[model samples]
Target: MKTLHFALPFVLIAVGCDMSPDYKQPELPVPSEWNTADDAERDSSHISAIGWKEFFTSPELQAVIDAALDNNRDLRIAVLNVEAARALYRIEKADQLLQIDAAANSSHQHLTEAEGAGPDGRTANHYQANLASTAFELDLFGRVHNESEAALETFFATEAARDAAQVTLIAETVNAYLQWLVDRETLDLLQRSLASREKSLELVTARQEIGLSSKLDLASAQAAVESVKVSRAIYSRFVEEDRNALALLIGKHDESLLPAEASLENTTILEDLPIALPSNVLLKRPDVREAEHQLKSANANIGAARAAFFPRITLTGSVGFASNDLGDLFTTEAAGAWSFIPQISIPIFDNGRNAANLDYSEVRKNIAVARYEKAIQNGFREVNNSLAARRLIREQLDAQRRLASAREEAYTLAHARYEAGLDSLLESLIAQDDMLAAQQAEIDALRQELSNTVTLYKVLGGGVLR
Candidate 1:
């Protein structure tokens, strides 16, 4: 035992070298900055540095996002996934250390007279107690170390996935809320149009009875009122459906928190969101970071696979006391014993199993590298698309607003001309139709502008760092 103890330190020193291959981060092909017509001035603060509560200034919308984060089942599952990966990492780390157990046992056996060699048969009794570590691998080739590292990387990847889920949730919630408000405003606009059309119908009817307007004019006015009614019905349906969508996003059926009578003009979402350099996306985006961690884990797996081709050594030892009498189990009369077992397993012949494992690990690493690069590429594309929209959408919204205002003025003049007997009822109806369509377009454009901003905020990896 003493000789073995003296040689243990030398044995560890001799076999301390790890057979695992050295790890290097995979190279990714990426551009330094986004390809925009004009470089956007860099913001002093990053978008991700802002929390959802701060970015979305609406108290009501912020409450909805917070509720979704808390109650959404998918977010709950993501959090649980992170916890499971963390527990798995802890288990793997624990496996790298020695496991010792204390044990006590008593045994009794009856022997026949021929076997006992006494005048009569007798029962034999035994008692034992010990501390033991069984088959603890030495990790000389770094197989265990690599596996633990892979587990740790996997845990980090899951954490990133959870963050990605959170960012998506917040964006979806905000978009749904904005859409609800826009639909409500559209419905309100249509109802007001309906009231004006009803008054026009009454005016035309009165003129026709007094022989000032023809039957054709009265019929046109009635058709205009019905058209406004149809539009109002459609918009009312949209408002209700938007409410339903918001409920689903918040993972609850509560209606009290719905955005009440809000309009595109009054709801507060920032028109200007800070843009980041394309290269920084890899660091800010959680999904991209998650993919990178997955790639790293695959790289560590390759090391574990390589180490499998080498010999594995294990050690099991026990030190204890034993006595036939229970009372003397811990006394000086008790027998003291100890054991040391050193085992080596070398792969002499395998039908290419180890080689196949190494090949599989390498293939996995290749797949992970491709996925990592693809994630970065996709992230860059999203940011570019958002930036492009950010550049042009404001112009589109401005044009839509001006068109709506001009159409409203044209409708007013047309109605006045018809009333003063200078224009046909058909002309007034046409102008009114154009005005309604223009108003609807303006509302839609406003919603689009808001949705694009939200998309940019999300694609740029906002709402994660906080």
Candidate 2:
């Protein structure tokens, strides 16, 4: 009988089988080299260590970034999600080992015989007590291992997702702050230009009264001054709105309290940017790592789904004692128990549930692979676009500066010629317009260049999340 029992275990092992299909990842569509980085040297110092302080270089902006990271609602949510994933992974890992549970119970019962005879039917009282009960499943195969690994991958994915959120948050804050700076600078410029135009109009009108200028020229100069004032008014409102936007990005909306400062010209700089490659290794952006983790998690799920077609072997057991007398329940002489029930479940038919699951897993794995490839391609595209944008903006800035300088010189010459009766008032007006336009264009180019750098930081996956 003992030999038969030992052979039964081997027989059950043979009975368990699976028929689920295997999973394969889809082909990658991404290129080996990124379009932007023609030569991204893999050096140790190539990575960006430019933190919020170094990148922003403004005390106020750094403070705002710190506050946003501390108070942002989205960041709080991401942190909670990471905790949840960690808990789930821990649970899955713990489940791999045996789980034991204990229970205590006491019962009393009275029974009466339904028959009567020379010996009359009598009532009997019984008492029973049990201290604990334990049950566990023995994992002989790798089912638990696959499940644990899947859970761990999900944990990593969530963690990476949180980091991705942080990167986006920082980028948004920088963009908002820069926008506020530009608006402030533009407002100041408009105000100053309006004042200058008003003074020019007064001078031209006085010349007309003295019979040195025509009435038509005086009217044109006054009209131009009025238009500048109108523009200044419009820009004033926009400046307030931009300040409000900056407040919102920092998780606050009280514009008066935020105290936005710093002009764009003072804060923005266009120069030869350092190209760091080695530091990028450590800054493995959350999105790229997140995509990879998602793929791994999907791969693990495929293993679990394929396991569905296979039979499962489980060993169930229980040991306990029950007695008519509560006092004797703990005694070994009164022990009563049955245990060690090992069973094997073979999947004879499931109406295609297992097959469908296998197919779903395969499709999901394919999707994950595609998503991973797309992320890489998108990352490369972003890098290329940012670098190109920066290059173009720098060139534009150079051209605008030269144009502004020429226009300024022309405006000075035209003003002197008009005073000497050698040039018309229209010529001075046109020169001033050209100068203002060129100055505005230079501002635009510089702001765009800085914005491009921000995009570069994001595309290169800066800001490590550790």
Candidate 3:
């Protein structure tokens, strides 16, 4: 019993592996202050947890996003990347456990000189079967543990990347829809304006023939009508081409196009701007989260590299039944054969290779941390800029409305005077042009305002889609 007791220690050490490493979340700067506005309190409790449906709210826009998520090639590629990372993590997890293997062998030797030493000191036919490991590293120095952590972090990073892709997809879809709406409205206005100008040209021609105006006056009116028609043709082409672009972004492979529209219903043109707290908002951004997860993976690499300087202990072992005949391979009397080899290797020296690895890992981790911090700062910048834009655009829209109203009155007055013979052909034409410009500008300003609100939604980590 005493002898057995002494042998059990060796068996236990040989048969078991404990490779878990000490892990802790790395330290980095966190904001003690937040950017808050009266319009909102910083609600930081996983605002991103909401489904995209709740965030976007528009059935048309949501449909576009759903289609893109399903068909977008970039999103599919990110999913593939996550799969690859998961496979790597599985490999790392397997490293923490002992592995078993099996093998079989048979030999019949016709001695070259009729003389050879077998296991029993005689030339003979031999057969054997065994289950054994070729090599297994004992992770006593935490190398395997750190490697596993690195793999886990990489998996998490991929998850965050997927979320970031989702955010980008939603943003692009909304922007494309807004662009389509802007183009359509502009095109519609141009078409109507062209028709009105043509009627004016006809009137001027008739009046010149009746001696109510000179030929020069008629020519000027006709020229204005032609110029507007030319502009209409250009705008029509632009509208059609942009609609096609939106369809592509929504992952359309067929001729079918998206229900392109204005985001006006989807967002508010605020009489008062909505503002959010900026302090912890950056952390919720998928891009920032992705960057931080990458930093964690890099930090895990440092632990792995640091562990390389220590001794590596490995246990290579095999246990299997043996027999001289195939029929007896698993027979009760075919007693099992077994072996255990516990090995320890120290990197006494590596001509600076191991040390360099350690330095490189640490430096890389530092770089990753810096990158994560930079991403956070950039996120804050986007949020703040979006807020400022929303505020300024609201003011612009108001001013543009006033200008449009004034130009509208001027147009009516000019046309009246021309009909009453108080204004020249040139004056009426100029006033018509000014009115069109003001009206177009008003539409542009409203479009800009809606766009700013969407930007705010995105910069705020995008409603629940975060």
Candidate 4:
């Protein structure tokens, strides 16, 4: 027993040797600055520093986003995944520690006279109680330690994934809400246009009845009214569909949760993101962080694989007392038995299985590296795209608003001329059609601008803080 105790310290000292490789983060695969960032002003504050509640100023939108964070099914699944990964990590970490189990057992045997027993049959009973540790690895080559590290990294990756899911959910919910508002506004515009076109049709019919207008004029007026009706129908359906989509995201069907009336023009969102920020901000993004964590896990897996090439040492031990009489089980006079088993399994022959595992782990690490780089590149592209949209969409929206205004003026003039018998009703109808098209275009541009704002917030990792 004393010899075994003395040798255990030397065996434990061997655990200090680690075969895992050191890990270093890969270099960034993208440019240092954004292409569209030339005209952007520099700001010290990063977009990620701002929480979602601060970024989305609308109270209604804030409420809706909060509900989504709480009730979204995908987010729930993401949270659960994090928990499961944490549990797996715990299981791996436990492998590195000592685990002692208490066990008790009793045995009975009978020997007949015809067998190896004496003339008379004999019965025997045995009882035992012990504390034992079974097949505990010594981690001499860091296989178990590296495996624990890999599991820990995987847990962190899942946490980052949960954050990514949350960021995406917030962005989608906000965009859906904005789309619904835009659809409602468009529907209202179509309804008003239809009313005006219907009144014009009534006037054109009365004029034709009195022989003051031709059939062509009446037919043109009727066609204009029908066109507006068709647009109204389409937009009305769009509004309802948008509502359903928003409801699905919110995870509730209550009509009261949605606003009865809202306007895209009235909606407010934070638009000034720090466009001149450094590319390192991409690292703060949840998706990018998730990819990095996955890469770290793969790197750690390589360490475990490398460790597998070395010998593994396992120890099994037990200390117990055995006695024929049940009452003598704990007595000092009873026989005290103990066992120590130290097993060493050297990698002498495996048909290249360990080599294959090392190669596979290296390949997985390479794949993870590529994925991490791709994530950074994707984030860079999304930010640049949003920045370009932010600059160009504002200019385009300005032009659209101006065009709609001009069209409105042109329609008014054409209608006035027709009423004064200075122009044909065909000119008036054409101007009205152009005016409606321009108005719709302007509304669409506004919606795009708002949606882009929300998208910029998401791509920049704004909602993760919240």
Q: TM-scores across all candidates?
A: 0.93, 0.83, 0.87, 0.93
Off by over 4 Å in 1: 1-16, 19-21, 116-120
Query: Candidate 3, residue 344: CA error in Å?
Result: 1.5
lDDT tens per residue, model 3, 427-458: 98999899889888888887787777667666
In model 1, how large is the Cα lDDT of residue 447? 84
| Candidate 1 clashes between residue pairs 3 or more apart in a chain or in different chains | none
Best by lDDT: 4
What's the CA error at residue 426 for candidate 4, in Å?
1.5
lDDT of 1: 0.84
Model 4 lDDT on a 0 to 1 scale: 0.88
Residue 58 lDDT in candidate 1: 72
Q: All candidates' lDDT scores?
A: 0.84, 0.70, 0.74, 0.88
In the predicted model 4, the residue pairs found to clash are none
- Residue 297 displacement in candidate 2 (angstroms): 0.9
Query: Ten-residue segment with the worst summed lDDT in candidate 3?
Result: 267-276
lDDT per residue as tens, model 1, 1-466: 9999999997787466554456666655678777762555555456777776667777677778878887888889999999999999999999899999999999998888899648788888899999999999989888998899999999999999999999998898888888887778788888888888898899889989999999999988898898888878887898889888877778898876774644667667765666666665556688988988998899889888888888899999999999999999999989997899999999889999999999999999889889988888888888878778876888999999999999999999998998888999999999999998899889889888888888987888876644
| TM-score of model 4 vs. true structure | 0.93
- Could you give the candidate ranking by lDDT, starting with the highest? 4, 1, 3, 2
